[model samples]
Target: MNFPLILFILLVITGSIWLLDIIFWKKKREPNENEPWWIEYPKSFFPIILIVFSLRSFVIEPFKIPSGSMIPTLLVGDFILVNKYVYGIRLPVINKKIYDMDKPKRGDVLVFRFPEDSSIDYIKRIVGLPGDVITYHDKQLIINGEVIRMEYEGDYKYIESGLGYIYSDRYSEYLNDESHSIIINQDIRGVQFSNVRQFQFRDNCKYRRTGFTCEVPAGNYFTLGDNRDSSSDSRYWGFVPEENIVGKAFMIWWNFGDLGRIGLSIK
Candidate 1:
């Protein structure tokens, strides 16, 4: 559901009624009697709706991690706060940027609306920027013909609630100056690149048996989940347009399952 759109509608309704009552209906009602239900309710809710709408629309917004695609960095059930204005100021509902700000850097975790289905939101790490060539082979990431530094960490284990434990090799990948951990399961093989859906800029990418190589188009970005082996990301889909960006996820505010995860900074 589009919560922002709903909030915006409520804000408009309440704000209008409150304003109309102040300008025209305030003196029409007797001071002794209760105000009309419509005006009273709207007046009561107008300030609240306006405040919430302003904050969520232009400042920060909260989101929950529903999948383990981010694994060690962001676990399932982690409630995160995304900085909306860090990238740019965009209008709510119809997200159109009206201000310019910093572009996404490599290794930054980003929240974006899925290109194929804008209603669906996805979170992933920025791996490739526009005009860069990204290649993945033998579970290693190569950008612009240079192999990105990857230092083996250790075995990473994930516990599924109903299922048993899953294990993968963990590595700290260095992109630009920032570093983040990623997990790749050798037992889990990737699908043939031919099986991927035809997405925008498909012609720019070349897929093979081992991995794929792509030149990120202008104003677009290539993203991947930290859980490399299990994620269905830009490698399977396509580059995310700048306009699809929601915000940069900064911190984990809550995790019901693991209290220790609360207030952890998201890299």
Candidate 2:
């Protein structure tokens, strides 16, 4: 979550409630016409409760898909909700896990803090799990020393998704530990196999051109995007630490220009 937006919302809600109480609900016996210290005190908690419920229940929470990284799966303006407790219930802001829910599967779309900058949130798929060796050479996924069968029909065309764009290809991978549909575009190159250098976990990753290999750290996991070629993810920013995980995105609640986009599960 963005700090500025969180702080601004907190201020707005707290300030609104406090102002209302002062002007309309002030105790008649109060001696001071000037603001009372006690009223301001409780006003502070309005934002606190809001922040708590939002962070705790929702986990990763809802964020505008800012870029096309998860395109075809998530759009730029698609308002999607992430269930914070899907993977596990974690405290908001600090992001401490309290209870276990489920482990990340190969095909689930997820949101996590950027390993490079924990302040920034990035979305990607669980292409590789802890102890899994993943290779993406020539646009094919190799896991644990075997190619995970990808059929290529040559170039795929994609429409623009929000602030970013989407390329389409028919891909099928695993979810819930089973094979499913995934999208990839051969054009997505550049940062696909390279891990970001300037952050934690540099010792855990290795690089190559035919493909790169990284050992998913014990407490960390690797992620990719269903919309390949368009996402800046763990492949570039490094692995998502256990603490940096937000939640699992389940559905598209709303989308602009495409009313039909509502209620689509991530594939």
Candidate 3:
């Protein structure tokens, strides 16, 4: 629950105590007197906690993948590191950018707060930027009237925790300058309109028997999961707002079940 906020609270508490001891408490105590437990503990922890909080808030942060939504790129047990300052340095807890930096690029894997539920975080690959027209018809991705290149890789299969083995067709999809693997379940025929929710800019999207098309609104992004049919992403919910962005995921630092994944760069 709200790790950043909790860290911030601890930072304030410890920092205040450390400063108070330095300015008032320490000076008032006799030179040879030992410090009280409260002062000693907080003073000792303040520096260490400050270093951790600073690194986590503005440098890089660790996250563990918990779902199959980003299956091919990030597994359920994968522990990834998100670069916090790549898109810009945002304030801790509030998540408001105070400095400007590079904008999010298409094909970049990103972590962001779910629009419908701010408390929850989700990861997906960026497909469309602001002002882009994204269309998904018959499992093909079209952006701005041009079809994105998708080269067939081969058949792919994976085990879902409670569902046993699932199979799909895998392809290397090229978006912008990057190419990443994506899976499509041929069994799922078309976009199910019933699953698309009436989100804020629902009027901008049109659903059909084949699929759907949407013009990405200003300051928002369209994303899709690598595991196409298994994901509940922008197609079913809505675009990710600029403010909801967390950071760009860059590497997999740990994977208990698959040690080979450690130190692998995230595509």
Best by TM-score: 3
**lDDT of model number 1:** 0.91
How well is each residue in 182-257 modelled by candidate 1, as lDDT tens digits? 9989886554455489999899998887888999999999999999876779988999999999999999999888
Stretches off by above 4 angstroms in model 1 are: 190-195
| lDDT leader | 3
Pairs clashing within candidate 3: none
Between candidates 1 and 3, name the one with more favorable TM-score. Answer: 3
Any runs in candidate 2 off by more than 4 Å, and if so which? 1-60, 152-155, 160-168, 175-180, 187-198
Estimate, for each residue in 105-199, the C-alpha lDDT of model 2 and write its tens digit. 77777778776677887778887787877777766777778777655544455666334544467665644456655567656563544335554
lDDT of 3: 0.93
Candidate 1 has its poorest 10 consecutive residues by lDDT at 187-196
Q: Output the lDDT of residue 125, model 2.
A: 80
TM value for model 3: 0.98
Pairs with steric clashes in candidate 1: none
Q: Estimate each model's TM-score.
A: 0.97, 0.75, 0.98
